[model samples]
Target: MAVVDHAPGSGHRTAGDPGGPGPRGLGRIGAVPPRRRIDPADGLAAVTAWRTASDGSPPPRPVLATAVRWTLAELADRYPGGACEVRVPPFGVVQCIPGPRHTRGTPPNVVETDADTWLALATGRTTWADAVATGRVSASGERADLSGLLPLE
Candidate 1:
């Protein structure tokens, strides 16, 4: 398990520590809280904010990165198996769709796309077929078709 320590005088509670500042009455002294997991809602918020921006400009790198990571991670969680490798370069990759697991070498099923294209597909701004037709996505293998699992919203 990973741990996170609050700074001194931060008044945060630590697990199993008495007399702390938080509701649990645990003090920050020598506290080793578990590391926070990435929240998918946070990532979705980032993407939504970028998509709804009035200026119609591309999202900042950090926001885009967060959105991509969240969506891909969500897919992995939902599918819960490593039969397909989904790749969005420079952002995130996850193995999903239940079938044969690839432990070595390139996976039999692979899908690759740029961050923008992925974000578009994930947010329902674009469809998988349209993206493929426009040459925005490159997919291989029998299970590479993610049309049924896209627009993760």
Candidate 2:
């Protein structure tokens, strides 16, 4: 799972766990803890917003961030256990699939792409083979191909 820094002094948030606590025990204080994972429903909302943008204009950073994070998190949530690491730079990374777990050094299975490509693939805007053929994605290891599980839309 991807690990990200949440609010200051708050505990780290793993990609698959959205209900984790926030800074200084905020959840214990009855405050809503910061979201660590993307809720599938919320992800759908983000996707809708993006798809409805006028003239193909890109949504704001927050919207894109939400969509990207949610999709990636949802992927992690669906595929429990760590066998492959998927990376969307400047947005998030998630460990998924089910097989031998990688602990250190270069992971055996890895998939990487820019945020746009990842979003496109996740939303069915592009195919895994097209992304790979066009050099928009870099995948390594036997289990790194996610064509079967893509278009999470």
Candidate 3:
């Protein structure tokens, strides 16, 4: 089981991702939800909405927000243009670094990849230089050189 540290004042808890049922997640995959007679779709919709929403609100504690935030912060720091520059397709698009901004056509620097790959890079599971070197990620332009910052977490 993975060990997680507790917040300074909160009670200790573990939510899945550790070897047992998580408090708010789908427990054990097949075990019934704590509440009775609820449609499965509702739960799925909630999680999906939470994942896609743009409110910038953090997910509830004892949830996956730690990993998510870690991923975002890592990406934010690693990407040269900062958090406002990079752009992802479905999950997020942020910009990083300080460079001449482009308004039309392709910006001289651009990096595009799928969500999973981006998440992986953000979480330190992959490296920007390695991903680009391996041809798994596409990078273009001089200012677009992200070797200085990458693999967020």
**Quick one: best TM-score, which candidate?**
1
User: What TM-score would each prediction reach against the true structure?
Assistant: 0.73, 0.72, 0.45
In the order shown, the candidates' Cα RMSDs to the true structure are: 8.6, 9.3, 17.6
What TM value does model 1 have? Answer: 0.73
Give the lDDT ranking, best first.
1, 2, 3
lDDT preference between candidates 1 and 3, better one:
1
Residue-wise C-alpha lDDT for candidate 3, range 1-153, written one tens digit per residue: 867776744745446444434755555655555522223354334344445542477445323333333344445545545313454554445456776766556577777765556555654567888777777667677666655666432
lDDT of 1 by residue, 1-153 (tens): 777799766876575457554654433455556533468679768788768752488877888888888888878878878899999999888899999999779999999999888988988899999999999999999999999998887
Model 3 CA deviation exceeding 4 Å by range: 1-85
Candidate 1 residues lying further than 4 Å off, grouped into runs, are 1-36, 53-55
Per residue, candidate 2 scores C-alpha lDDT tens digits across 58-145 of 8887888888899898888778667899999888888999999997788999999987888889888889999999999999999999
| lDDT of model 1 at position 93 | 89
Q: What lDDT is reached at residue 102 by model 2?
A: 90
lDDT (Cα atoms) of all candidates against the true structure: 0.83, 0.82, 0.53
| Candidate 1: residue 14 lDDT (0-100) | 71
